[model samples]
Target: MDGTREMKDSKQLISNIQAQYPRLSKGQKLIAQYILSNYDKVAFMTACKLGETVGVSESTVVRFANALGYSGYPKLQDALQELIKNRLTTVQRVEMANEYSDDTTILNKVLKSDIDNIRGTLEEVDEKAFEEASNKLLNARKIYILGMRSSFTVAQYLGFYLDIILDSVHIIRMDMGDAFEQIVRINENDVVVAISFPRYSKKSFEVVSYAKEKGAHVISLTDSIFAPVASIADNVLLVKSNMASFVDSLVPALSISNALIISVGMKEKEEIKEHFDDLEKIWKMYSVYE
Candidate 1:
């Protein structure tokens, strides 16, 4: 099938599998059960390995994929990977952590995973999109930053420096009880910088969707193009966060945010210098630091 058709048919892979369960043969049902229960593992497994795990022949797996309307097992695997990319939970992550035993050097594995994630992010990031996002922030009349859960740290970090150097920067805080109320004032002249990673918050997606509907330009910092936020974003910055343990790696995400902030500051050097100079005087007046 073509890309468009594949996307339309496989919008919800698990749902599709369940919907067709009744018609599936006994061997296909075995493959389906293994996949539904251990998708994280199946996403990375080869057809041969999966066949061995499910006690089915490699041809059986391929037949099952064909029955699901995919070109082959690889296509089905890709759908599975996309489905779980940003939805893995903490409990699921801990289960993943348990896969490594006492003999495994988990610290090195995690560090290596972060290195690979950063390298992959750099490789896949669209330079044109990055430049466009930076320009939007630099030119916007106001900037609104949004993030929740683990992503909150990245949003807060970016917002802090932006607040220092730019005018009218707002960090949408859930603690305030009415994040939507705060963003109701956003309009076409504003920009929303939304951050989200695996186990993405429904609220963050809804808020970003609302911002897009309000005609605000949205700059998404997320794991992949398949991310829900990416669907509505005017500009997307892809950052990889794959890790071996339960915790998602933030090192690469933070690097992207840092680069964006630095780029925006470089574009407004004169304004940044003046703002910092005024802040320095206020700091001295109050003896804010030694």
Candidate 2:
């Protein structure tokens, strides 16, 4: 799966408002342009700093964020960070590839990057948000996973592991038509975990949209708050996949998936153990021991 397949959608609503806001004050327009054009910069910029650049009051910046459906400036800034962390640059890809010139270096770099990703993820991830998502997955009568291309791996891994850890985990990897067919069965008792990253796939986004319409709870894991799936999700898990060029780094995404699997398993340890025992018996019957 390609890295670009993982981006769910551009969910940054504030920026969208700036583009579509019918009657914006001059100050709001400036702030809006700066935010839309320099999202990465804005993510790290203080309200004062952003105001200084946009020539607006700090209060105006906060207002701009609120106007875009965010809680305030902090929420806006966090959204930017989430977007940048997922958007990959050409130079960065070359650097990542260059850094992994040898097998040993590749292993070390990938492992180290994954570990760093987990650390950063912990810092940025909202614990309450994750707990909510975990509960949704745990209690949902059915779970449908939608992931395309590279994200398909994450979705498949999640669905597969969760099937062992829980029950009623279904991974959707077929074409859009098949996805729609499966999604129609989803109801309030079901949950959809949509995986996408930068250069988000259109198919994945559509699936999430459809799932939401069916009243299924959505759990999104993607790069940006501005991503398409974010607004639709009941809970969004922002996974950072700093890329170098067109290619994305999956080590971080994999870490997030593993963590979610562990968390789900922990929540249903007894059930998971029973499932594992049954699976072991099947493996033995099939003589599939490795």
Candidate 3:
């Protein structure tokens, strides 16, 4: 689907709570109070856990979500998470991480959460957008890879693989000057693949807007349809990188990149095989590896 949908206002969750607070059941009021005071923890909790903490039954928690105009608890939880994701500070993030430090099974907890993120991504991904992104990447006269902060790692990974398979792939670098300088040459025949997640880089929107104005195809790799990058993109690839601690889990982001790369790489399999064969010979000659 084209990424032109109106951005959902996450703050509406707050207004909903305030308007409904007085009408809520006694147990629901307790839930609302905890959420206002400690949303970071509430965002990560299951409906059952939230109910227990708020002195209510799990069914009561579900009812609270419905009272807030959400169809279900998950929807309400998502609103809470989105509301706080970008507003979190470094100290707050560290505190979020400390919530798990007392557990002996932290490793299992983290891995399972990442696994769930991958599953959610698979369930919600737009196949049409994925295909469009792949086709655009293949046909572009040139490709610009853009990301910043933690997102840079995903951009770098995608750029590395795409460069090996496509001769026109270029990663936009911040160190070289302004981010716009690298993409100033973009045109209608070019494609811009930009990645951004919660705590998104403002630079992403600026660069992407400029590229779109210049007539380039824009592909956004991000966590939500509400993300600023998604609104300006020609294709939006949604992936869940749910928080595992202070940082988001990038396993889902990398998984989608792997899928996109393999999809594009297979189309040029014969040429890629020859290129790799030549690289293997050069590597062996130079003793690049033991």
Report the C-alpha lDDT of model 1 over 58-120, residue by residue, as the tens digit: 999999999898988866866676666656777876776754566557767777778977986
Better of 1 and 2 by lDDT: 1
Model 1 CA deviation exceeding 4 Å by range: 1-38, 42-80, 99-104
Task: Indicate whether candidate 2 or candidate 3 has the larger TM-score.
Answer: 3
Worst 10 residues of 3 by lDDT: 1-10
Candidate whose TM-score is highest: 3
lDDT of 3 at 182: 85
What residue pairs clash in candidate 1, if any at all?
Answer: 86-199
Predicted structure 1: clash tally = 1
lDDT by residue (45-91, candidate 3, tens digit) is 98998988888999999999878767678777777777788778867
lDDT of 1: 0.86
For candidate 1, which ten residues in a row score worst on lDDT?
Answer: 2-11
On the 0 to 100 scale, the lDDT of residue 10 in model 1 is 53
Q: At residue 66, what lDDT does model 1 achieve?
A: 94
User: Whole-model Cα lDDT per candidate?
Assistant: 0.86, 0.74, 0.87
The full ranking of all candidates by lDDT, starting with the best, is 3, 1, 2
TM-score of each: 0.75, 0.65, 0.91
Q: Cα lDDT for residue 11, model 3?
A: 63
